[model samples]
Target: MFEQALGIFLMLAILSVLIVVHECGHFLVARLFGFQTPVFGVGLPFGPYISLGRKWNTEFRIYAFLLGGFVAIPELGDETNASNSSEAFGVELNPFKKFPIWQRALVAVAGVTFNAIFAYFLMVVMFFSVGRQVEQTYVSALDPSNPIAKQAGVLAGDDIVALDKHPVTSTHEVIAYLGNRKSTPVTLSLIRDGKPLDLVMTTSPKGKVGMVLGQKPAQYIKIDAGPVETLGLAGSELVDRTRLMVVGLAEMVQALTPDFGPAQPGAPPKPGFKNLHGVLAVVKIGAGMVQIDWRSMFMFTIMISMDLAIINLLPWPALDGGHLAFMLVEAIRGKPIEERAHGEMVKWGFLSLIALMVLVMVNDVSALMNGELDIKPEMKEKLKGR
Candidate 1:
């Protein structure tokens, strides 16, 4: 229990710190470009900041909300005048009253780049400092009670070395391989008590393996590499993870439409704000990481970080992506749009965000009540079979 609590604390601390850094990237870039920044905060205007600072003598000041931070740049509500500049009323940076379109776009993109760097560094530390867990290729428990195990001649303690000619490294891979019930007669390669063996297993109707396996202690393996190789690996992983998240979100959105299959068959028909997950999910995942081993925990953290970075890149109001979209249009048209038009767009975006939040909260509550969202008792039992 103490271990779990400590793990939760660490996870939360890491998440909070990373988010603050991400926001800081934007704040710093905006400040460098001479934008007027005011208040910067995190955690929905309610949470307290861990650190706060400001430029005392200068025209602009900085504050760290600890929970999160943002630069109150000069571009709010059509006002683009630099804070220190004494320009005409309602006018921005000299000609257009705001920084160049490219400058604004760079400010928006900076946060995302920072997040990717943060994730990469975190992964490097997780891999080298903590070490990676070795692949577990054994079936720790066959549970004689499980019919599928019996049918496949796989007894408890049997070491499953491979699946359909593919090497098995972890219990996760074991389930993923055997869980293919949709494919008839799954193949398996086993090594029982030093004797090599081959076998085939069948899946249940729901594409389940119908059996559970356990894991042994994690083995610490060393990675030998120069700084260049280490940096390359980290960068590659971050890029891949980011790409996966962006593609996954696009697929999810596509799935929500009527042209696709039924809309999750459980919630509302359209994709709205309610689908948005907030701090609750963050807290839960952080808590779960401590309970599990470090490798799983850190891997999950990487996934979540990738998700956060990608989600913020979406083109919607009040988001970096939205700001980016406007900048792009300005770049193409050779001028910024009217202030009134931009304000209306922001207003609609705010309303949409609020509506979506309500839906997500409802969905979270519903999932809690239905016992579908949280890990089920049976699933836990299945995981612990080893």
Candidate 2:
């Protein structure tokens, strides 16, 4: 129970910090360009809020909905909407002087830019402390149903280097290979205590021999990266994680089709909308990770930061990327968009974003009830090695 509380706290705190940093990027860049940002608030704009008074042409306040942050950069677009008022904030939107396209673009991109920078910074700290995690095929435990491998003297911590004389890299490879050859005799080349041995065993009919696998530094060793190497690795990690998210998002969209079916058998489900979730699942999974090792939060935080950056970059209204897209259209047209049309699109986008959030929340609840979000005990034991 205490673990659950800590997990929630950590998740919210981390997210709040990321939000602040993102908003600060826009605020600072706007100030740099000498634009008056009438309001900068932590959390969403609507709902009951308390004003922290004005500072440097910005009215700082904390809002009740603490999931997102915003700054009123008047030059960017229609900063004063129905929920927000320039008159209430005691600042006037400049009527005559608006920043050029380049400046507006910079302000729009700054939030994402800051998120990227902060993610890399976190990566540096993690590399220096816990090093980079390179997941591999290591047996962390033996299942009670241990049929062949356990009886053949396989033990925990044994690295399965090759199976059937072919090198196997990830746990997925090992599981897939064994699952396909159920009840068939196969040779496993394992490294135990730094020594290698070949053991011939037959898998159960289900293709599993009670060997449990672990990923993300649980069953693998860490590589302490140097300064230069860390930079290269950090860059690669950002790109890799971003690519994975893109693929996951695309799969989710594909899953929206009527004909899509479930992926994977005798293993974890493949990425799709069926498994796509929102903040609830994040807190649940994050709490599980925290209970195992606080260091795990670094990876979670980095992923969330990158996810925010990517999600905001989507060319939708009510998002940073949407604002940038508007700027692009404005650039080509040689004038700003009609005020009412732009505002209407933003209103619709805001509603769409909320509706999507509600749907994902429902998904999160359903997943929790079905026990799909629970962390496997075998994986937990592997992380415990730290």
Candidate 3:
């Protein structure tokens, strides 16, 4: 019970910190460019709030709901509803705009830029503390009816030594090799029961052997990395993780179609409401990470930070990317979008986000009631191997 409470606190704290960091990026860049920043809020600018004094012609505020934060730079020209959105939210804009389009673009992108940087820094710290996780081709489960592997004598807990006589240490390597040669004969060199064994099998047309791969902490050997090497590794980690996330998001959208099919062998079941995590889901799973050690928290925080950055980069209404899209359209046509249309779109977008949040919460509640939200139970079994 205590672990669960601590996990909830940590998740909320991390979300608040990420939001503030993202907002700070915009606040700093706008101030640097001498923009008329009327308000810099620590929390979402809504409802009852307390003023935290004024500095540099800017009023700082803390709102009642502290889930996210925002900054208001009047010169950036989100002044569609000056009387309502601007004044009601303490974000009143001056009549005249001063900054050029390019400068506005920089200010708009700074939030995501800061998020990316923050993720990288976390990666560096994690690497320095516990080193990078090395992937191993360790077999955790096999299909009960896997005739070829069973006939050729493959067993659970075997270390996959190679695929087709090519030495391999990672499951990804074996997958890539098979994917390139579909429906082919394969030779697996494995180490089982402290003895080397060979297993030959014909893969499915999709190049699957019907085995589940899992790596525990005990199977990972960490290597000390130099500073320069760590920088390269950190940058590579960011790029790779971002690419995987983008692919996963695209797949999720595709799976929403009416004719969506089951995932390929060994792939996770297609994500939907049940697997789509939100605040409740994160807190539940985060409790498990908290109980494990600091390493889990580091990975979770880094990934969540990057996720926030990526989500903001999407060209959806009321997002930073949407503002950039508007600027782009203006750049092409030499005039900004119509004020009414912009205001309407932003209003609807904000509503849509709230709706999405509510839907996710409902799904989370259902999953919790079904006894599927807690991760601590599974962690007990998995951690024993580690």
Candidate 3's residue-wise lDDT over 34-148, tens digit each? 8777878887666888999888878899998898788876567663344454656555455655568999999989999999899899888777767664445778888775555
- In model 1, the runs with Cα more than 4 Å from the true position are 1-11, 46-53, 56-68, 76-97, 133-220, 260-277, 369-386
Q: What's the C-alpha lDDT at position 243 in model 3? A: 67
lDDT of 2 at 215: 52
lDDT of 2 by residue, 193-273 (tens): 889989888888988788897553453245565679878887887776676677666556765655455654666544555
Candidate 1, residues 80-119, lDDT tens digits: the string is 3244323422213433244577777878888887887777
Q: lDDT of all predictions, in order shown?
A: 0.63, 0.80, 0.75
Each model's TM-score?
Answer: 0.65, 0.75, 0.82
* Each model's total of backbone clashes: 14, 0, 0
- Residue 231 error for model 1, in Å? 2.1
Candidate 1: minimum summed lDDT over ten consecutive residues — where?
Answer: 88-97
Best-first order by lDDT: 2, 3, 1
Best by TM-score: 3
Best by lDDT: 2
